[model samples]
Target chain A: MNAPLLKIDQLSASAGGAPVLHGVSLEVNAGEVHAIMGPNGSGKSTLAHVLAGRPGYVITGGTVRFDGADLLALPAEERARAGLFLGFQYPVEIPGVSNAYLLKAALNACRRQRGEQDIDAFDFLNLVRDKMRTMHIDEALLTRGVNEGFSGGEKKRNEILQMLVMEPRLALLDETDSGLDIDALKIVGRGINSLRAAERAVVVITHYQRLLDYVVPDQVHVLARGRIVRSGDRALALELERRGYDWLLEAAPAMA
Target chain B: MKALERILADFGSPADAGPARLAAAEALSTHALPTRRDENWRYANLRALEAVRTFLPGPAPSISPALPPALPGYSRLVFIDGRLQPQHSLPDTALLGSLRRSAAGSADAGPVPFAFSGDGRFGLIARMFAPEPIALRVAGSLALELISITTAQACGSYLELDLELAAHAQLELVERHLGGAGPTGLSCVQVDLQLAEQAQSTHTRLLQGAPDALHYDTVAVTVGAGAQYLLRQVSAGAQTARSTIQVRLSGREARTQIRALATAHEAQVCDALFTVLHEAPGTRSDQLFRGIASDRAHVACSADVQVSAGAPGARVVQSLRGLIDGAGAEVDLRPRLTINTDEVQAAHGATTGRLDEDLLFYLLARGLSPVEARSLLKWAFLAEALNAIDAPALRRAAGQGAAARLADTPATELLQ
Candidate 1:
């Protein structure tokens, strides 16, 4: 009866004047998780970046709607303030800004936008410490620069820690599990799982099915050549893992 | 050329002129001011100097000027218009007795007891016109604050500081140069530092002049065997500022560290030339400089390190970086290393670039406004050099000063 929380209709995008995504469509409803698995250069990351309003990407056709508003019209920061979070595949290292300072500033910015007062210092510290424990992050990293000199696993964990703090309405994760190890993947999965609620939606983009073992998405879609060629339940991920992308590429042109 | 001639004509040798003062004036009579053709003076804004009408010392203010709050555990000395204000100074009698305010170019102190290698013309000017050169000798642990304030006078102001540390002594010195409300004026400063064997000295200098002022300074230092010298400098004011610094590792195993930051905006020009000579075996030096130019400003830093044949097993490291924030702004960084000996380790790099776009986008993606993001990144870039300061009070003061220059909101919070 209710419209999907996010709706993408015939969305086509290009990067550097080269077409990357062609006529892609998808819908995600609140209280549900969707997994997008694709081979290299299949445009999975492009779709997520386009939805987040990243610079350097042009929407060639169609539209994206988030919470009944035209998402493509907003800037990156405005989209962020409107409760959209993107977990970058490779997080940036900012050497001079402390992790705590950035987290507090971001949280305060969001709160101010919602007509709420700044979070009390004491409360902010407590919340960060609790999330750090859940994400298995060291307490000392809080005072260090944002992901400065962090190991690959540590960077992923920090991204999850930030997501846990912001608690956005919709989270688009771009290969967040690529460099994570078994233990780190579990911690990150648990962090994302905690954000699952009746009013929140999640879209996980990845190359493998291992992350699905922990988060367990409700639906899985196979994207080939910028188009979803197959859709199924969680069993679809297992089938792809067993058969490999060669079988899909053989059948992709027919489906297109 | 006319400015130099005018300065020489205006200087009718005074009654207090000593042999050194006479020699300096005589040298200036025949020596010509350096032009853009000179290698070391190429980036200097010499046009500003040619516009000066008078080279006479600014008259000392009759009333004591307001001073910044004193740092904890540090004795304070105030100088207004090149004249020492003893009433405003709170010096420990025993240690303060060594600070002598001699006559202008007093020869009894003996030609600084150190060799001079920086631009001799400016040193000559200070030697010829400075009211009195303050010489201080330290034989034990002490912390001292020297504040020099230039008033609203149209004439030039000059000061020469002579500091010597005895063997095995420790000293912490904080020097501040501030400009009183005024129009454009010239401030020429010369500092000479000599450290004995096994001695240690930490020097911090802050230059905050008026927006329309001209400032030129030359600092020469000699480090003795097993001695350590550390200098941290921050320049954030003046329409045109230039500094030339040279350090000679005269004794074996001497060590030196120099860190500097220059922030220029709005048609300002800041230039610095730093040189370190390893003359003895096993001497080491590390230098780092960071500069930011915004809104049509220009910033330049040239760092040179040289190892002599006598200095085998020497170590040298130099890192110079500059950031430009506006289309018309310009920053230049040059790192030079010349080694004539074997078995030496030297690394040098220089880079000038705009702010990293990825870093900016990272902040924006977190909901920060464009201005806030830019301010934070700029503060962070300058903080890299400020973080090396060991003194908390000095670091805090430098951070606040830098934040104010960046127009960063809530200076206290930014520093924290």
Candidate 2:
């Protein structure tokens, strides 16, 4: 933890100049896994998008540092090439571009930024073959267009496959477990765990504690009204599962 | 000078014997409007054609135009003002040499067009200009071959052409019609094709109408035994534009398919009509045409199909769509079916609509500005239709061309 992988200081954001996330702060250290669980409109997805530099949500206050560099100043792809990745809740469908081609493009984009010549086609194929075998994924998935006409489980696993291939320094999984079955969940979790390293960090955003059972996180936080109201170890998620947001509502009126 | 008019008057009066078939035909059809003399000139307005009667015969004016590269792995031929410009290219092959020689010797004989079945401006020019027929003869079975046509003039007379492909040859043909509407220019074309047994062909046309720009073109496709044919035509809003495709399957086990799509802007009119005929038993045909009119642009589209009796295995499918961009854009799409054969599966459908709400929402939610979202959907819709091209280069170029015309949409963000 000499220099934590990502540091967020009093970060605030607005959509159409109206507050969405108000004074949110968090930290993720190398090799650590953090989980953010919240109800709808709790800004869970917004936080993931902001970190990936998606357009339109203006950063109003505070700062975000990823690997010692400013995160807010980069474009979405630039942030990606900088070792930050967001597995979209709803993966896009690029009709003519095959999944393998897209993944390779992303890998090359990242490698090029790090001043490395892109992996040749033969090397890329070999790399993909190995990753697919380990993740229990099939080669046919790579031949089709990116996530096009994919089933719910297929889309989620595709996201994990992307994560496995890119091996980003920081990965954000936005509701990756939402539409997946228990078996698919186990596969995704295994894929994530296999990549755990001191050079990388992970943040899995979910609406329920069910996902925590598969990929245990070192830290858990409850976010509501654009703010993280509670923080604890793995037990915090178990508490939210039993109690819901009832106590947060009871405390907010008096605090106001 | 109206190339057709001034020159034709002199040749008939014997002050000119410059009968380089194309040159001679240009002179004869150069009149102002449908006079009693022009055979194919009755239904459409020739007022714009007449206005340019005094125009000095200018060179094929120098142009600085650009279009998207062809789909990968395909041979390509690009043309400007109906003349194959040196700037465009095609893959090297013997078929390439044959087609070039055929065009120069142009329009060899074929069966006569059934008179009065399809008519107006382009028909007149086609009948009057190329008596022999501009043929695209395919020698053997080949893939990934493409041909494109473009017009970039503001005001000019019509250029009549006859395009034909011989039996046993296979390829993809793309006709791209473009021009400036200022000063009221006119372009007219006639394309004819032939496909033999075990041969396949596909044709795509993209056009926009000018306020005073009157554009008219016709396509005729004939297929032999066990051959396949696919045709699609797309139009943008304009002053007036009309394209008609007539196809027939004569040999047993022959198959044919046709589609037409149009997106019109303000104060414009477009018509995409198709005629399908199954002359023999075991022949099949399918056609779908969709059109959209936005920004107060109006369109009149129709389809006429006839399947001769005794063709027990004829099949057909057709549809049309139109989207009204603004308050004033208008569209008219019609599909007709004629069948004489029993035991046949044939269907035709047409639709005219506004922007699709679901498609719009999906794109906007992804951080694309509203305009950018609309533009992507527009191009995607056209791309799906163009994707049917056997030649990837034709598909890529058509998609890129249609996307560029959507200037208001900032699609430049994702295209590269």
Candidate 3:
């Protein structure tokens, strides 16, 4: 589909000298939603952090492309500027820096890299006000330091708020459902659903099928021992939830 | 000669000697000022202070400097070389009254002649062996009261402000050490403030001292029962400015908070020592000090907390965080606690680190140049404690002093 928005060819990432994702190849066409699911140690979070360019995660051998650009060669921030976003498994707390300020800076950064002049603060705040309303994110939260002292639910919502503001082309949700209640799950899922667009792609990383119930992905892949050993439609997630990954391991080879 | 020794010798006689003459004494103390060579004082430069040994101490005739007075509003304590220059001070109409008059005028005023000793600027500042001390008593029960102290001269000086805060009093003491290089000299000054019963005294000290001078000052606060005393100090990477603070909860139900901050650049060294003694029942004390060091500068200090068994229902938490950068830059933080009681809550933590790379990436990705990102993070380290100040002017001024220090960094882009 028009030069896959993101293509990961045989991607392998490691942490602490131990490999997590091993030779995993994936491709996401623009406007596609790809969900990666597996049992524990499935490297879901690793892929998210590695994709985000967090330090300590080494990409051993692979090529990541975004909009046909060499994503692997770019810094995490540059990748972000190129329309990539990662909703962290654990949103970091940066005390003293207001969330609104950070989001505005991030949005302007992307715009500047895309050859647009910076928007004035007055206009920028007005734009953010609309996005905050759709996500149901508290304007008060935006005024506080970035995620500092926020509850588990608030942090997840804050991440979605950033996604709403940044409007990245490729968004990676890393276990965004953990620590969220049913009500919060619906709110977060609705937030993600609203972002679905013909020009945007999303990667949902989850361990529970409950999250999939709301933010249904078009495709789901099971990762075991680092490699994705199974792939299918949304039903695969439900199947894995019914019978854990151990059953699949009996039928599959040690792909990792 | 070592800067501290020269400082001690200079103050040894400055009725007006102003720490300027000790520049000639042989630095016999084999103890080198902390350096990259020394482990504790590793982040700070000991030599920059050594070179400052010769500048004569004098008052700045000029209007301002790279680092000017941040807190412009307040009754200033103007000192030059250990002597108070009343001429440079605010108008004589600014003098409220004598300590006794202050206590007598306010219905909430308490006792007088409060004193305590803790190893720090106060330990040194307390050396006013003279029987008569400078006393300025304040009207009790006044809200939003502030006293500003200005170190106008470039030499070592001693200042003792005997303040009497009547019961249920809220007092804000803003002390700004303003003045730049004069003969490239150094100075050490002592500041003492006394608070009365049920009084809430919030003290914020902004360091705009001579870049190359040695600033060693002390704050002795003896809080009364049901009284609240909060002390906040920000240093602008002094050549060697060490302000020691001693807080003693001598009365039951006393609360004391000590938040001291230092941001050092180049080879300057700023150290703070705090001695908090929980000697009374139901007393509480908290200490948080963070230092951001860049360019081989050094900031080191120790927080000593002593909670005797006699003081039950007391809680003490002390935390020290340091961000050290550049090859030789270092921060040495030591938090010592002696708790003889089994019923009190006591926690001590010390963190020394460089700028957070992840946070740095997050900021730089947001379009902030690398320098601006680092500056924001450094300022963030201070906002928690400084923001707690109620006075907008003093808070803004404190923030300015912090920003000016960071602005001197070679890679700083935020200042631009």
Candidate 4:
């Protein structure tokens, strides 16, 4: 009714001259969580990256509308300033930039874009500390380099911490739970769930439904070969877990 | 050859010439200035040397130039145009008592040992014409700050610093080179360090010459048994700057660590060469170099480590990285290791390229402007070396200096 928060229509994209997503369409409304379940090479990450305006992807034919504006027209940074966040599957390790510095800089950048003043240093520290507690991240890690030498679970937790702090309008998480253990996954889920509001949307891209156990999605979509072939509720996720992706792969072509 | 001849002619021996000074002048007269053909001098900007019309020492400025704020917990020594300004120095009498000055023909005028094998012409020139050399022998813990300021006179300046640490002594030295407004001419500096058994020394050098200045520095160090020498150097100024460092572990269990960063912008050229030799058994050495070049600038670093057959159980590690940010800029890093013994552990890596694209994208994806992202990455690259500075005050000063050179914005903003 209020024009879905994000509208992707017939989106076809290619990476390195090879087509990855072929005429896929999806819509995500505010206040709803969507789970995009797909097997390896299903172009789940590509779809998320394309929407977030990552370079090196050529949109063959498509359009992405965020909040009724042409999302595909903005650069990656502008897209970020526009309240779009993409949680990288494998977070990068920036050895010389401390975690606190990055978090503060990023938060300030976003605030400046929104015509707001920079967050006070004292307030920022308190906010970060509270979020770190929720994410189960050690306070010492804030002084260390950004994810530098962090274990797999720690990196995932850091991504979640960043997401909770940024509070984007739409969050596209690409396999953030891949390397996370059960405890860490619960923390990450809590971190993500804390950001849900009547005006925010989240798209969780994963192969398994374990993350959904903590942050349940209102809608589930099975993407195979770059196209969403099935749409259902939470039962769809359990069904996929019960029956591997082969059945979907078998039905994907016909559905297309 | 003409440049060498001109320098020799301009720098006639002082009237009180000692044997060491005379020997240095004689050495220069016999050998031509090093050219590109010399392997060690291949990357040097020799043209800067040839451009000099005269190599005469600069006269003291009529007005004292402004100096950077002094570091806490250190006594300061100020030098203007190669001449010590005693009035501006803050001397700690107990430790300053060991400080000695030797002019030509003075009793302390013995030939200073230099481990550098490259063209020793620069050191020779400094020896022949520099003002009274400052020599310090330390027997107790001390912190000293030496500031050398070159005024806006188109004349050469030279300084030689010799340091000797007694057994089990500890010393921290912060040396800074600042240039006055406009062209500061050529400045040559030679430093020799000798560490006794179990002695430790931490030396940090900052070179911030004027935009049109030419700088050449040579540092030679010998570590004795169980002694440790650490050198943290940052070069962010001068149109053509070159520093050659050589460290020799002569006694068993000696150790040395060198962390150097060179930031070159505009059309400037910055070059550094580090050679470490493990001549005794159980010696260890670690070297890290980071260079950044932008806006048609050139930066080069060459690290060479050698383990002799007699130096069994020696360990060596070298990491050299360079970043080029401009289309016309160039960065070169070379890490070389030569081991003659089977019981040596050596690891070396060298890389020169633009900033990591993924790292850049990660920053951009977080809403940082491109300029902010680039500056942050560049700061991070240099911080790897700057962070190794043990003193927090010195580290912040160095970081601010480096950040200033890499960006047009305030260093505090960029560093943050």
Candidate 5:
């Protein structure tokens, strides 16, 4: 339905010349949330990076179609301008570039792509003030260099803040809940939930099921050794939380 | 005559000069001009200086060139072609009074006064041929804007400046060196700074020479007990620009900071050398330099920090970063820290590369194209040193100018 916001078929990739994601396939439709739960080294982050067009990741064989266009053919910034956003697991610290500057530039790029004018300075400030409040971030952090010296939880919140401002069509959250505490997790979950709409899609790639508890996913998939072995509903996440991933890997030799 | 001989002939014989000038000339003859064999001149050749030796000094500039607007709240002292243009400066009775007289009298004013010692061949030439040496005894918080303009291509120019600060005094000085278009011949400047106990000074030098000009500058400073000193130098638009800075921390708790930014594009060559000596205990020094080389240009920086054997509790840190974009662009960066005492802390680093790929990718992910990302990262790298400028307005102006100049360089793609 609706051309499936994103469709990946037989996607095989490698990072640093080593095979990571092997023939992984998935489809995400607009107006829906999907959860990918896997153990470490299951190519969870690799899939997210590949979708965002990060360099150093070789696509051995695969196809990623975003709204009926080849996503792999675009550059990183082109992908970003085309409504594809990746919330990095470890937000990079860029010195001398303020957070506000980064967000304004990113938002203007998306706006230009959408045939809209750039936001005025005064209006931009007001908009960010509101987003900061919703994300529980300090206004002082906006003046600081991008992610420079930011705490783990603060960095995650900043990611959500950026996502909110840009409002991309497809948002990929790669382990956004990895180092966040219970309170931070709830805030991030709420920030992400507020952006969910009938015309947007989100893929939450995480190692634990706790994040899914706050922002429940409509579909849950178990990715083992770079392949999606089982696909189910919310019950699958609950079962994975109770049974862990080892059982799934042991039960199916094909997953190995 | 040889190149050095021709230069010496323009200034006449050393016998007619003052003691300092005589000593400088003798030193020049004794120690030949710097050569590639010298470790300090490893990356810079003195052939330009040799080529300009035959150019004689022009007549004193009759009319001063239109100088840039002064930084607000600063008094001006303008010099054109090595001659002081008092008509263009503010009326500082004491300052003008000293300029009317010989500077030799003021440099040797009181006990423990400051003086210049010739350290290189160019220093000697500056002393021997310097038309007018502006020497001053500063007191009671002084803010000054000094402009030195070089005109008349057929002739050369040399300047010698000596300034001493009294105890507990403060000084903020900005020096601008501008050369005429299509310039020829050599321009040499020597500045000696002597800070008394508890004195503080912030010195900024903006050096802009003609695309074909040659320049040699040397600054020697001695820091007293409980004194502080900061020097920020930005040099650009020169065919061959060489700067040497020497500092001696002679008293306890004396602190100093040095930041230098050099941009060399086209066929320009920019060289900076810093030698810091720690002679007393509990002294500290921080040095940083940033260079951008493009289009077959070259930039070189050499920093040497030496702590005496008995100078304990000394701390020193030095960092150098160079951006080399385009084919044949070269950057030679050398940072050395020699600590003779076991109780000292010293760290030095030198890095020369195009740019950080991960940082570039991070910016790209923020929706910046490749060119925009490289420009931002380049500005960020140079800002690390530009932040050392104490004046906010001046820093902002210089930063914007540098960014605009660097924005045109070709972006080196992330081939990695």
Candidate 6:
């Protein structure tokens, strides 16, 4: 009876004058995690970026609605304040902004947007420390520049750390498990799973099914050639991991 | 012609000026003020100097300068306008004394090192009328602070500083220049430094001038064998300011490192020129400069590093970054390296760009507004240079001052 938390209808987008997503549609409800898996160059990351309002992507047609609001109309930062978060695949390395300072500024930004007072510096530090423990992040890294000179696994953990601090209503995690090791993947998965609640939703875009094993998805969709060619459940990801996408491509030769 | 007459009248007579001043004046008379054709003056136009030409020179301000927080076991010298304020300066010890009093019988009685340059009209002008310098010699590890103040009066002022460190000596020097509100003033400063064999020196300079004052500074240093010279500078708050720093590694294994940060706002212009020469084998130099401009401001940094023909194993590296935040904000960065030697390592990088879009989006996704995100990035761009400062207190103060200048730039909002 209630509208889905996110609904993408006939969304078509182009990057650098080349169309990447063509007539792709999907719906995600709260309290559920959806995984979109495909082979390389399947527009998985593009969908995440478009949803997060990244520039350089031209939307030719279709619409995206979040909580029944026209999500496409909001700016990137405004969308963030309205409870949308994106976990970058390759986290940006900012050489001068300390991790702790960034987290505090971001948390305060969200608080101000909700008409709430900012957290005190001491309290903010405690909050970050607790999250850092769960994320297996070093406290020393918090004093250094954001992701500057951080290892691949450390950068991924930082992305999740930020996600935990923001507690956004709708989160898009783009290949968060790509560069992470096995242990890091588990920690990141546990961190994401902890945020699962009745009022929040997540969309995980991954190429490998190993991530889906930790963060079990309620639904799995196969995207290829700018379109979603198949949709299934947990079993679907297992099948793709076993048989690869050749079977699906053979079935939809024209679109592939 | 009228300006020269006014200068001579204010200066009294060339007879009183020691040989250094006489020679400097003769050179100034022979070589005219630099024109646009001169490479050094190409980016800096001094038409405004003519406006303040008639402003007569006045006596040094007698007011006490505001002393900075003292470092433990350190020495200090305070100067107002160009004259040394002995009562306000630090207590004289065995290591520090007035140049006139100490140099009377020492081997240093001759002309000060690096005090004369043919291309410096302002340097020559400063030499003609400036009082004796406040000098300090470091025989052991020492920390010194030099404070120069310009009051509301004394519209045109000249000051000079001279330092000679003994062999194997170690010194850390901090220079602070404060200018109060004044009639269109011109403040000229010359620093002559020499580092004996195996000596080490770290120098930090902060220049905060009046909104409409003109500041001209020239510094020359020669490093001996196996010596090291490290200098960091931060300048702001002047309508027109120019600094020329020259260093020559005159002996084998000598090295120099220079890190400079400059900012300008509200129609101000700041220029920095650096020249480092490697004349001895195995000498090295590293130079980095960063500049930020907003609110119709202009900032420029130019550096040249030369490795002489026979100076093998010489190395030079340079990096420059500039950020332009508002309309009409101009930033120019030129890093030039000339290596005449076949076996030398020299490299340079210079870039002027706006905030990165991807970086902005990352910040935005974390819930920061467009303006907040932009402000953070802009501040970070300048903080990169500030962090290189070794003194924590100075670094903190410098970072805060840079932020105040950047507060006027409005946060950039998303186009959508």
Q: How well is candidate 6 docked (DockQ)?
A: 0.74
The C-alpha stretches of model 2 lying farther than 4 A from their native spots are: A1-3, A16-18, A252-256, B1-120, B131-188, B194-216, B222-227, B232-243, B248-255, B258-387, B391-416
The number of the candidate with the highest TM-score is: 4
Candidate 6: tens digits of C-alpha lDDT, residues A23-96: 89999999989999988888999999898899899998999999999999988888888888999999999987
**Local accuracy of candidate 2 as per-residue lDDT tens digits, B109-199:** 3333532343433554544432123344566544433333334444333343444445666666666666532344555566667677767
Off by over 4 Å in 3: B1-73, B76-134, B141-160, B166-170, B181-183, B356-373, B407-416
lDDT string for model 3 (A1-256, tens) is: 2888888889998999988889888888888888998878878788877877777888888888889988878776787888888887777788977787688778878888889987787988898888778767788887799888999999998888888878889899989999999988998998898899999989999988898888888889887777778889999998988888898777656644
Estimate how well candidate 5 is docked, as a DockQ score: 0.66
- Candidate 1, clashing residue pairs? none
- Cα RMSDs of all predictions? 2.0, 8.1, 6.1, 1.8, 3.6, 3.8
- The TM-score ranking, best first, is 4, 1, 5, 6, 3, 2
Q: After superposition, how far is residue A168 of candidate 3 from its true place, in Å?
A: 0.4
lDDT for each residue of candidate 1 in B1-416, tens digit (9 for 90 to 100) = 58778788778868778887787777767666778788878888988887777889877678657788889889988877777888988888865788876577767644642223335477777777888788888888889988888773678888888888999988898888888866748888878888999999998988887788888887888899999999999988888988888888999999999989998888989999888999999999999999988889889998989899999989999999998977899898878899999999988888899888778777777888778888888877887788887778778777766555553443256675
Chain B TM-scores per candidate, in order, are: 0.95, 0.74, 0.74, 0.96, 0.91, 0.91
Best by lDDT: 4
lDDT of 1 at B109: 49
Q: What is the clash count for each candidate, in the order shown?
A: 0, 57, 19, 0, 0, 0
Least accurate 10 contiguous residues by lDDT in model 1 chain A: A247-256
Poorest lDDT segment (10 consecutive residues) of candidate 5 chain A: A247-256
Local lDDT at A39 for model 5? 89
Put down candidate 5 lDDT per residue, B20-49, tens digits, no spaces: 666565667767577777888877757776
Q: What overall lDDT, based on C-alpha atoms, would model 1 receive against the true structure? A: 0.85
lDDT, candidate 3, B38-57, per-residue tens: 43333333355565433333
| Candidate with more favorable, higher DockQ: 1 or 2 | 1
Between candidates 2 and 5, the one scoring higher on TM-score is 5
User: If the candidates were sorted by their DockQ against the true structure, best first, what order would they fall in?
Assistant: 4, 1, 6, 5, 3, 2
